[model samples]
Target: MALRGTNQEFGRPYNRRIVLESIRLHGPIARGDIARRVGLTVQTVSTIVRELEEHGYVLSVREEPRGRGLPPATLRINPEGGYAVGIHITPLGIDAALTNLSGDVIESAHREAPNATPDLAFDLIGAMVNDLTGLRPGGRVLGIGMALPGPFGVESMSFVGPTTMTGWKDVSLRERLAASTGLPAFFETDMAAAAMGERLYGLGTGYSEYYYLYFGVGLGGVMVHDGSALRGAWGNAGEIGHIPVVPGGEACPCGNRGCLERYLSLEARGRWSGSDADWVAEIGPVFRNAIAVVENLFDPETVILGGLASTDLLERLAGSATQLPNSVSARRDRASPRIIVGRGGQYAVLRGAAALAVSGVLSPRFGQMFTAERERGRDLLQGKGMAA
Candidate 1:
């Protein structure tokens, strides 16, 4: 669902974020249009816009008037107002990206850290941040967003599996990153980060409710509802790779037999020597079954396929897995395709890691509904001598 703003005194920050969200999504937009879209008064929107301009978060643009008294000025995000760095960690390597307020990737770096420990990952991250920050001297860096392999807080799946990184479960990654980079640090699973990237700057932008099926080192998914990620109680909602698609399939380090990732992931494909087409043909049936399960379970507006895979491979997989099984998504009145590839490119997770900071700044949090007004993720931002 679209976010709406309230006129209450306590909701001022939320209103500001709501206005920023509107502008980021549709700008250069008139203040009147933003007011109508976000359920706020024109006066309230104007106040917020003025404050945003003073803070250098929004810029005013003018268009030629056809025959009006004066050309109206519109608002847009100021690309140089802020910057964010995103880091994606996996057993295979570490990826980092620096993005501006407009979500454009300005610089990126990749380093191999096979079976990386916390210390090793931190070292790589420090080098990346230093190099990235140098590109824009004295740039106002909003924060750092880190995407780690997940199933966090779970013993069996957190750090003891083939898909996840190990020797770092007890380390406070967020706090450490904040200290090392001298910036506020935000954290999320790689899957969640990828999904969040899609939500803010990719295919999920057009749909509030959609399933992001990530094709990374392993298969993962995230169900986004009302523009909020449906993170489970323990923050591992979309570990679909562990689901048993084959009754007696290959064994997974998670202690599951016939797990979906065993037959439908990059790691699975790497074990085979066949050509790309041959690999797709081999896993076509398994892929279709997984898609069917995702559709019936989430019933999202559409399912997005993306992540560390190449565009050609992702499209080939999407094309080859045809004749989809009948499910709730097969209704005749559907407005969107049942399946579509994400447009965030191969480094989507890295972009999402950056977006974590951007969203934290521009998007209102669902958690604010029950709690008193406060800075989002301030606990991580504070005590590190960083501004929130």
Candidate 2:
């Protein structure tokens, strides 16, 4: 399979990642099955599997058959192989959690940040990691994944554009976290991470194309196509928040008039309601407009309402959307895409981050061993090394 990044001199890491992803996606599969699935030979698969088993990332189960020459062995992911730490930083506070391979939260710590700031935020994250790692030493935390309120660059681990987050522009969050915790770090914008979480374990299950609208202090968007995020040029593909909806309504932080976020975000609703059923009545129109935009543009398989928004609010908005007249010309018997509420809600982003981090560690591509093995394999094929 084609690798996504620059070719590494050591290729074992890539192979490891491939093998791990195969097992994670299709476990209880035999070594021969894994080889066929990953496009690797049986010998290569066995080598990688043995190394994975030795490293505690894979476990084997013996299968007894009614009539068989020998019992076949099935391979599965070791849920306890390693742990991933995920954090979601919102305006109100920071939510930190640790999850295993199965995406089960083993420990969680919430820190209230009455006065949110970059310095305080980083400190809170460090403290949370320390707390969770201490609580589950046996889990061997591999790294940290942060879901922040901003736009993350697709090619890099930095914020892409202006964000509602204070003092977050051009911040090297990954480096800061690695320095603070002495562990590898990965980062994603809150919306994209939430979308990932939903795709893997929430309302997005079985849907290849969908949109996850993150309604928080600010509105954000995440688009998934073919089971992967569709990050546009400069990683700004999903900045639907800045999409002009009202034309000349309200001034937005992105220097636009009447951006979609100004009309539909939680903060906007709070202002509209003046604390009168603030969560529900205020966001109703915004949700309607958002649904209309999604339908006109992507017509996705489903549009998931998530982020910090409440499910009750989502249900109300979904009901309201259905009442709107279809704008499509000569509409036929095609079913309208369902507007569903997400399971993780506010915690979705953090959980998605945890999932990415865990996937990175448990699989071989994220580890050093996999890269080395691939490099050696290439060298041997090139006749640079003598065959045994």
Which candidate has the top score in lDDT?
1
CA error at residue 32 for candidate 2, angstroms: 1.4
The count of backbone overlaps in candidate 1 is 1
For every model shown, the clashing-pair count is 1, 15
Report how far residue 12 has shifted in candidate 2, in Å: 3.5
- Give one digit per residue, the lDDT tens place, for model 2 in 20-112: 678887888998888877778788788878777877778999877768576779899888877789988877688988887767788888998
Runs in model 1 lying further than 4 Å from the true structure? 1-18, 33-48, 334-336, 362-388
Clashes counted in candidate 2 amount to 15
* Residues 1-388, model 1: lDDT tens digits: 6779986754766787788888987899999999999999999899878877877788999887789577778999899888999999888998898999877899999998898888888888998999998999977787789998787888766776667887777889778998888876788999999998888788888998999998888889999998888998878899999998888778888887999988888888888899889999999988988898999999999999988888888898899766999999999999988889999876688888888877764576634321432633342212233232
Which runs in model 2 stand beyond 4 Å of their true positions? 1-9, 63-71, 152-163, 274-283, 327-337, 361-388
- Against the true structure, candidate 1 has what lDDT? 0.84
- Worst 10 contiguous positions by lDDT, candidate 1: 379-388
lDDT over C-alpha atoms for residue 138 of model 2: 64
List pairs with backbone clashes in candidate 1.
1-226
